[model samples]
Target: MNATEKFYLPVDGIFDMFTSLTSPSAVTHPVVQSAVAPQQHPKAPSFSKTGMGIIRMVKESWRQPMAHRSSSSSTGRQLSIERQAKRSVDLLELGLAKPKNCHRIVVLGAARVGKTNILQRFLGNDFDESYAPTAEDFHRKLFHIGGDAYQVDLLDAASERNFPAKRRLSILTGDTFLLVFSLDDRESLHHVRDMLDEIAAAKAKLLKLKHPAKVPAVICGNKADLTSPGAVTRSEVTQALGKDVTYFETSAKDGTGLEGAFRALAALGGLPDETSPSRHQLISLLSYQTLCISQRGRGGLRARGHGAPCAAMDPLARRPSFTSDLRLLLKSGSNKNNKPEMCHVQ
Candidate 1:
């Protein structure tokens, strides 16, 4: 059939053996032999309200950053202002007041790629050996990076071979994206490219804007702990996926790179830096918070363990955290025609 030919799909077979492409010239739907020519008006598919709501939420959260500072004489201040101005308006901070914070990250990839395992390990610090199919799930995690309140949400989307259309649609809610793929299954990597295409189309439709999306994304290669000698390397990952993205190797089972991946996404959405919180500053914050808690007579805190409840409960628990610029865009591979782009963190 011709590329522009309008084909009909059966109501029953539509759910199976069918996938849509965002490319205008690509096949939009499966074609059946017994089907008649499609009507002039293409029937709009029944979309899940939650799926659309998530898309709108992401679009709305990505707004023009407010003018946090009017002027600063030094080049450092000017650079800071310019950088902050590129972020979302929702991240604006008040003078000496509570820090305004939020970030939504959606993890997506093919089935059995350890999507759930990643979240489970990162948030609950646990892992499961059993495989349980999920359509869609959302979990909110509260984090304090450098004395700022950052509420992060991780959306685990169903990526099963039969993953429902609605669930796949809802994963678009991320301010940042984690394109999770398996190191063992190279085919899973193709899903990342397809998803990128889908996301680009979805963003254009939701925002009603012509400009390209500036949302940061991370390419997470899961099951790295199980990878053998022939596994892909970080350099290969950078070469395969270039620009507006970062790459990480994670193993959900042993919790390798889980925290770093989580913190990395949070930073993309304007969270605390991954390399921040120097030893001295962290020590000072702990000491100060400990003293305040002791004075308040709420002293169940122990000398050891920063993971104690005291860290979360104390009013002075927040500390100064640097916001690193994770503009981790890999311009192009060294073998490519283009020159290498420097990776900058401010």
Candidate 2:
């Protein structure tokens, strides 16, 4: 038989092709012999032209479904390849562009002002009262929304004013800043004011701009639960930070006001609205991967509630890089090929 010729199975043996029947010789049905050798047996009843046409029709029917399956598989593979190529191109273009979906948020505050606690609340964690001074902490939150991933990098800096260089570098690299002050501490409020000035000065110097650049910042008055006689009033804090600045009174212990503050922060930084703490669901890394895979499947996907799915990476998994930040900031400008000076922390 020619390779291109169709395999014509006997009427009774047609179904066996789908069953345990493998090769043509494996079909032991008597109909197979009758189909092939009508001239050999004189006692056998001869089939009419109509009956023979029906058998050919059945054979063609089986071939059609098999061809359809093969065609469908090829189409699926082509779609998969196109998706991967498009994704790769998008990532490459993103890398070439500055300010990728990931934005760094630097939190600045005086010691014991609940800066870390506020960040903890934003990350969907319980507040801890422990007073261990933080040297520096970095955290990343991944939000999966609209079939894309956006990252928010939170840098919790130490309150020590000794390393002005490190502080200045943080200011220069930060996409947005969160200035926290304790409501019960008047000095903490003063520290926030100083940091604001530092941020403005550092950005102006680094960008070589004559006018102060508009830095995206959110001021938080923490320790709202504490009411001290000498505490800074809301009106006074507003006056000190400037009325134009976005401000919030938050109690990390009570978990109040943090959500709104985070939403405002996300808005100011030009991040997706779903990056807001209240707008996304907290999921484990494993669940995040599973959901991402499901979203990429060919089957139509339905949204899970109104919230976007999110996951948090280990805080210590990635260290902050000044060189990388400087590159990103410089690339964000029109001069893409310019080599910038390294932001020396020491």
Candidate 3:
């Protein structure tokens, strides 16, 4: 017999029986039992009848391959459990990935028209009286609305007349423009026409090259805090620009009309609204306006005209530099050399 069968065999008679059973030529089987000793004489007759029979029955039951079957089943279950754990971790990483298609909105306006103040009011709920000019072309901010994240980049360039071409290109980067004008100054209001012309030119270049859709424009009449009985009216602005254009009278000083203005922008940018059930809701209504006047200023707003004329463009004029008015406002009380934030969200 093999080594395993030899270990199970009894010392004398068991070995002889196993050898005969394993032989291919053997046919007759022998059944035998050991003789009982004198100490076991009383039970010898009972042992021969039942005890030996029970021992043989137990050995026959264990001869089946029960242990080998159990070990194979346990190994298979362990492999399946390990594979499931790996798949769960991979799904979690994918869900945490950053969102794609984040929109960038750039704010453009003349200097000292409260563009930076408007941005600060939206980003941080505070305002500053004294702030410096913006040095970079863009500033970025993030918001979570309607279960989606949006990235807004507000661009306010130096309103000097030196580099018209560079400043024109900066205005082209925005998908939409918030053209800010001062209600207290007629000159600032008149500058909007020139601004629109430059914007249209930049858009035409994009169209010739088969670029994306043209950027939409919105006219904002700022300094509503200074609006008085004799100030320029919204009707006049519409007549000067067109009735088809979007308009808003906002007061950055008193935090008026800020929410509606931003919400309108979010809607125009194809951003989902928290209040809407649809996946993409277009901003259809634009009736939101602020008419509140500031108490700090005089009853009759005085008009402030141009103090410095725009410089002439040079052959070696430097490329236009755009700065975020928000960062400039944020750094008003601290460092002056901090780089303006410009990276896109997605």
Best by lDDT: 2
The TM-score of candidate 2 is 0.64
Off by over 4 Å in 3: 1-100, 159-161, 209-215, 274-346
- Give the better candidate number (1 or 3) by TM-score: 3
- Per-residue lDDT tens digits of candidate 1, residues 119-212? 7665554688899886436665443334433455566654433554444344334577888888887777777767766666655544545874
Q: Candidate 3's residue-wise lDDT over 22-127, tens digit each? A: 3445335322222112243554445444645555666666666564566767667655544433332111122311333244456666677777887666555367
TM-score of each: 0.47, 0.64, 0.48
The deviation in Å at residue 277 for candidate 3 is 20
Question: Which candidate, 1 or 2, has the higher TM-score?
Answer: 2
User: Candidate 1, which ten residues in sequence have the lowest lDDT sum?
Assistant: 319-328
Cα TM-score of candidate 3: 0.48
Q: CA RMSD for every model?
A: 26.2, 14.1, 26.7
**lDDT of all predictions:** 0.53, 0.68, 0.51
Error (Å) of candidate 2 at residue 336 is: 6.9
Native-referenced Cα lDDT, model 3: 0.51
Query: Best candidate per TM-score, number?
Result: 2
Clash list (residue pairs), candidate 1: 146-319, 146-320, 146-321, 147-319
Candidate 2 residue spans exceeding 4 A from truth:
1-99, 293-308, 329-346
